[model samples]
Target chain A: MKKSYITAILLVVFLLTGCWDQRLLKDVRLLLGVGIDYQKGNKVIMSSVVTRNLEKKPPELISTTGSTPRDARINLQRKLIYVPDASKNRIVMLSEALARKGSILEVLDVFYRDPRSALNAKIAIVKGKAKDFLETQSKDNPDLTAFLDRQIVTSEAATIVPDVDLQSIRTGILDPGEDIMMPYMGLNKSNVEILGGALFHGQKLTGTLTPGETTVALLLANQKNKQTTLTLPIEKGVQMTVNILQSKRKLTIQPTGQSLKVSIDLQMNAEAIEMPFGDFSDQKTVAKFNHTLSEEINKEADKVIKKLQAANCDVLGIGRQLIAHHSSYWNQIDWNKEYPKINITSSTTINLTRNGILE
Target chain B: MGTRQADKISRLELFFFILQSVIGIGILSLPYTVFSESKTDAWIAVLLAGIAITINMMINWKLSSHFPSANLFDFLPTLLGKYLSKAVSVGYIVYFLAVAYLVLLLFGDIITRWVLPRTPVLAIYFLLVSTSIYLARESLSVITRFCVIVSIFLPVLLILMLVPLNSSHFIYIFPIGQTGLEAIFKGAKETSFSIIGYELLLVIYPFVKGNHTQIRKVILLSSAFLTLFYTFLVFNCVIFFSSEELEQIPEPILYMLKSFSFRVIERIDLLFLSIWIVTVLTTFVNYLFAASIGIKQLFHQNDHRHFTLAAGFLCLLCAEFTGDRFLVQKISDFLAKASFLFVAGIPLLLLLIIYMKKLRWHGR
Candidate 1:
């Protein structure tokens, strides 16, 4: 009984001390956002926002730049009134210029190597200079990092413009025949706006897609959302706003002797939000609107497809589909050499549900 | 009856013991393995494998019912010829030892990479060995009672999965049937590896002190719980990452947990991983116990203490000689393939032999 009592006491002691490596909240500094850029003479510049202002007035933003992200982080440590741990950092912003040079791997090494770095943190590419976008303050939200994360979640836009988190970027860079895309943020005076999508061929930034072009990219990629809206032109002067209610896309790869044929089927349920010059009450007009909308969306989708084919981006992962379905044929043919010349057919079917609150 | 008295365990305790045995080190990598083969349709493979495992479990239980008070050790010789039974028992013992080694390697690798890079590998090995040996030395009832206490944290682990819910990309799992049926079927084989440890039921059958109906309920409930848990985790990884991403990551659950941040806590994966250490310890203890039990059965020893120590020492030696992570992974793959013989093929053959012998006796 005495031995059992002693054993029980020791076990309790061990359980009480639970995690010996536990760190209290007060002992660590929380980094909410990070930005990296290359300066004029072969120097690295980095800026980070610490969340010490969570209690202060309008959340203070501290800006620091150094020759490297690590160096800039050390510099921030020296300048800050309180020490902060960058391990909890949530957002990493890269300048378009720096991204063009393909140095994101270097800037991101700290996050990748550090065990405490959150792998789920959001990653974005800033248009022009990343510093300008990172420095932009929101009027209502005190914490810029939380505000930016919220915007990405709520928008759910259909573009190659995905909110590239750390896990996705890491996987995209590591995997074969797959590339990563990040949300493009541009600074307009004092505010930061999500411009479009930045496409990458491997880790290097290849090109940017405009918002209109991104819609087609998203549709082709089968990433369309329920809230996505499309605009249709019925005639030269008439226009209508259509909200996408449901969308489904299927990619089929057909073997034609020496070559492979790609076919895409797009099905959508849409409703007209505004009928500028057309009578919505007429079934015939609705049918005409549906046909015109289908044609316009298909035409827009074709232009993006042509551009992607020309660039060989494969952001739609059509090449992956071919490899998945027709592995033997895909291996026999050079995707890079044949992708530009392969025949692609885009088919669209649209069903118009209602004509807004007015109709 | 003497054997039954030595190995008796209650039905509820057996349920928790089997649950821990099935869930172990496999949960961490099953998602990656399944996804690498099947792409987005990996969840379907998990469902199929779950059904297959249930069928396997039913066969095993029925075979064990042939001798109500005996286990695999006593019944196998009657089913197969005596020499074949001994050969098969030796094969199973080696498989259990390999399981112990793989668990040690996996546990060591995770600790070195995630928690303590500077700590020497030997120290981690020692800590794990001591904890597992201490648990193995306990009686069957004691082990099950302790496991029941630890199993309470299993639900907590499930709740920790909700953190990834904040960042999941639902579209990542879209166009599910794009990978075709062949790829999905191939992936089901990988899922079967994760569900392999349920065959522990073959050894623990006599320890179960319950009505025949209750025993069936326990096994079915354990299988259902494991299936749901595995499917939930695989879905989490699938939705949390794209098909390409899931293929690249070795430990998707660890990577997914690293993404979460609460106002009070940062780097919750570290905390989550520490909890996972307990799970690993429980699994190692269970495998060690199984291996020791096999030894005792073969040698006809009443006391398992000496055999347990010897097994733990052998596992330690194997872990020490494993050298590097790459070789350890090679050994792991080898064991996964070899386990199919003991886990699937042997049991089916045993059931067939038992059924044929029963028919001949009735005809005579």
Candidate 2:
């Protein structure tokens, strides 16, 4: 009888403390990706894709219109069987129209304010309608999130796109000397491909960066893109592909009176993938080829700098370095106005380690 | 010799008893507070504060040694009259209640803001107070043993602070002495409250199984460790954020971790808060333990356990009175000012008075 009484007490103890926060696995819909697009009359159209299974075929899609992203999600709650959980979100896409307007900090702040919201979710700006990119299917992977994630990872490997998550992007947003540049994704027929990057002056998207220009910016920032390939036109008809095995950059800044003299030193280890017109094995040809490749890299870098200056983009974080190393000079001038007029130059030194199996 | 129950606290338990007593909630906002005044030189402030606390520990050691068998309550009447001693004891009891209440309010606020938004502040306060009372019912030896077990987990806590270095910048600590000496000292003054918990030694000295010299060693060692621990945290925070960015977020350590997440854990700040809530609760337990002992000594009460309930009631009442952050800050400022009398002012004054009385005896 006493043993039964002890058992009863133990059972009561277990029954007394209920799990108030208990969430069942089956009762929640996990949002994988969210696409934000602006409509006429300043309306925001939020489109979300909820992942149902690992097979990735028949997931749920919902689109709702509201003044804010939260409002849009709240509106979407009416149509879902379970609560929409964005904590598992892998990516967020902004339409070119919304990005061009550039006042997207408000839309992005919702993700930051909530502790449960995904801060590391990869963000991309569509070169066209974000809904189109979301609607399009990838031939290789049926899962759009997995497909887009792979594309982003490859782009970062090639140094064609920056490897910044939402948290890293927050630094550029809050920081005055630096600005954010995100991957520019676009729909190519049915497949959404990563084009290049969209440059931003704070939260407002300034302009687009070409694929080649993206490589120049990445190289200038010393962001390692080991597998990056540079294709050059040598002697009119002969084209050569130089696969960069490793790369590094050194940025030097000198404030002279009212102007800033900036020089970028790019050092790279590369291999000639296709040297069809050159001699099989000649030292003189290799010397000339190295000089030619260095000149090509510098030329591309100069063009990228010009475009960056025109857009007033401190994408290389040069302005931040100035603030850190030379605060007096940084305080003397307005970065936005002075950045476009700042004199900048670049020089590249490439050591061609190998010329492929033919060599 | 100490009572057999008092003698149960070993040398290691003695070290952790002081260590756990000192390292409470002060660490949460220590970096931000020091940085606000001294900027990048906040780590210097942490080191200086450690020195000041050690000096206080020396004075406390001198007094406790002067009266070996007696705790602060038993000897205060010998130094001052019975009425004055009673007044001082009541003041300490009130101080402990106020401090515990403040910690309860802070615990409730952090949990509400970061962990459980739906739970009422009263519920959180009740939970903390109830746990502290249950633990406070135990003897000092039992408490020290429990504290030793808790202090063993300090390394794990320190390791969690290191995870945010992946995205941190080392350049923030450069030009380290840019702030003037006055600013750094003023910053040290800002850290007085975080280092306030060491005063528990004045009450628990006889309870510890050690000679006076050994007591000083434990106190100094705890002070040094706390200094290094706080300095390490402050220095890491200074490195984690830019000089200007550190000012924007009040809790640099939490903010730094908020931006970082591991593969298995998303929102590492929440994980940190879960562990940190225990530290906050530890602070609550420390004060309640101190206050109950004060009650037992003052009234010659047979059992101190009853006073734990009374203390918890008073703490709950104080916590409930604090309805908003503005009021809490005001109360915290008042307590920070009042802490000087309890920690340093009274101990040093007692030492001076006793030394003067000794000189008179020698002259006679």
Candidate 3:
């Protein structure tokens, strides 16, 4: 009798577990890209690309405005037939105006607070109207998310821009000694293109570095730059294109009695890929090529440093090193004002290891 | 009692039993909690808590080995008077039930917020308690065997946590002693509440099938293992996030996993959470077992199964009070403070009392 009673209870339990929150695939929309724009009325406009079938149809673009990003999402929820989920959201794009107006941190609160938010979603700043970028329809590309993802990943490998996600953004903003820089994107003739690095002082967008300047910043920051081609003029009109194989950076923060002295040393190994100058006849030419490459890198590095200093953006994490090793020096001054005045120097050395098939 | 005296647990079973009981919902928020006091030195605080709790575990073993084949419920009357012992047993019962309910409440809240939005909170509450009672209703030997089986998830949990280390910033844990020695100790004091499950050693020591020396070795090994386990995870969290970053994330371990997405599995963190439910069930069963034993001794009942059912009902009822996040946090602080008295304070007093009585007997 007890055995029968237990079996019956187990059967009832099996029956009672009918799916309470089963969301069918056809009934839910997968949000791929979200674009948040700050408006002048102390409001925000959120735009998202939602799709029913990923491989079959082009995703639809939708926009709504509210007092906050989450509020805008709620308002957008009203217009959609199916439930919109952001857990699988691939990318988040903010307009230049919105990022400049700041409070991007406040807008990001929804992503951090909601457990369903995709923490690893790639975030980029749109150089123009973010809504326009989100509104760009898929031409040959099946998915805009796929396009943007490829662009960001490709540029990250090529060292055109640094990789930044929502998680890094939150940490960078919260971190006292360091700031963050994200990929700056723009609407091209057909698809999205990575422009450069969008520098941020805390949550606010301070300025931007051009593509050339961004490459130098990345190299000085000890970040990888695969397939990066460096064109150096060994002679007056002779330019050699050297492909960077590996790179290393060493940053030194010297503490004096009055202030902190910061400098960065960079080393790179490269191979001549498209040397338009001439064939490498002897070891002397390779040495000359290496010297020319080093000088060119140093020149660009100095330019990048000057731009960063003028913008007062410490994307190299100079302040982080000071805080970590020399906290007493960090506590003495206001970093925001003193950062622009602090002189940062950079030196680079290049080694042309091989000349590919020519040698 | 004479017939059941043959039931004994092996050393490996005891190891897993202690492990499962100590690591529950506490792991999900422990690093974040410890960081609030120790900052970058949170791992140091975790290490200190391990050392402190091991001493307490040794004391429990000493007290329990004195009365072979007997639990705290049976042997308390010898140390304290009958009335006081009865009162202390009742207090322990309430403490166990309260802790079990808090774990249940936190479990339900995490599931509702992270996994299931539409399922009623009571559904998880009922399912967890029913399964826990099933495990708790068994003999000590069977429960120990179940714990051995449940511990196989530990290696998988470790592998999942290690996956994120490839991308973490090791520099975040730098300036280690910057939070200072005092803050680290304070964090260790705060962390003591999390290591509460070792107190079960006081009750289960006699059931362990070993000599006094073996029991001491087992206790020390489990305590060391738990300390390393917790400190390893805490160290990982410190490296993965800065103090500012950890402050905002309530569950650093889960949040760290959320950042890592495997190609085959989209969210490994959610999978970790699902497997973690089994570990949480082990803790629930441990507390329920402890509480029911207290009830049996207090009421002079031969069948502890009835007491286990009553205890489950009381846990569910109490869990309802901590439904909101604010009250859940409030009662969590209250439980942590109260745990020090029962798990640490009273155990020391009992050991001292037993020592004094032994001294008196020797003098006579």
Cα-based TM-score, every candidate: 0.73, 0.90, 0.96
DockQ by candidate, in order = 0.19, 0.27, 0.60
Report the lDDT tens digits of candidate 1 across residue range B98-174: 89888888888888788766666766776787678878977777888877888988987899888888667555565
Q: Please tell me which model should have the higher DockQ, number 2 or number 3.
A: 3
DockQ of 1: 0.19
What's the C-alpha lDDT at position B273 in model 3?
Answer: 95
What would the TM-score be for candidate 1 when compared with the true structure? 0.73
* Worst 10-residue lDDT window, candidate 2 chain A: A13-22
Most accurate candidate by lDDT: 3
Using TM-score, give the best candidate's number. 3
Local error of candidate 2 at residue B218 (angstroms): 2.9
Backbone clash pairs for candidate 1 read A29-A84
lDDT (tens digit, per residue) of candidate 3 on B204-316: 87778879898789889999999999999999998888668899888888888887788999898898998899999999999999889888878888878888988997888
Worst 10 residues of 2 chain B by lDDT: B1-10
Clashes of each: 1, 1, 0
Candidate 2 local accuracy as lDDT? 0.79
lDDT: worst 10-residue window of model 3 chain A = A137-146
